[model samples]
Target: MDTLGALALATEPPTDNLMKRNPVGRREPLVTNIMWRNLFVQALYQVAILLIFDFDGVRILRLQNESRSNAEKVTNTFIFNTFVFCQWSICSSII
Candidate 1:
């Protein structure tokens, strides 16, 4: 080959060698999948919070009114109060 032809050949990357050495195709990154999973988990967490704050609160209040004994009423109130306190603490800590 001439000097210029030899120089060009030397500078050019060998496509055949590259293709043979790395046969695997490019793959999608894991970040998108991980982000979607995190969003799903967060949505489930919000649903759980709604169930606890709304449905459970209503049920507890109803039960409190139905109970005849003072002891049972006090126990139910205490449990509800504790739940509220814990929920508040969690919110405050997160903020």
Candidate 2:
């Protein structure tokens, strides 16, 4: 057999732990194949939204509020707030 086939035969499936008892005898699920697949699907959805949908809040705001005098200030504040929110989200998810 090829090396990849050998490796696959040697290792249990990602969800094997969820299906069977671990060394600790707990049946709780850790990170599993389903979780990884869900994460991958979410990432693809986000990428599709970003690329095909062209959902830009700043552009929409500028187009909708052209007469507003504080457009630059509003856009700058929006960008800063978005950056902070993304940073917070990533950090929280990691923890």
User: Number of the top candidate by TM-score?
Assistant: 2
**TM-score for candidate 2, residues paired by index:** 0.35
- TM-score, one value per model: 0.31, 0.35
lDDT of 1 by residue, 8-87 (tens): 65888778777689555568564688778966876677667655655465455555555457645555565667667655
Evaluate model 1: give its lDDT. 0.61
Number of the top candidate by lDDT?
Answer: 1
Which stretches of model 2 miss by more than 4 angstroms?
A: 1-58, 62-69
Q: Candidate 2 lDDT, tens digit per residue, 1-95?
A: 14555565568565766668546546757768988897787667655544432346547665455644476566656666655665465445544
Q: Please, what is the whole-model Cα lDDT of each candidate in the order they appear?
A: 0.61, 0.58
Clash number by candidate, in order: 0, 0
How many backbone collisions does model 2 have?
0
| Poorest 10 consecutive residues by lDDT, candidate 2 | 49-58
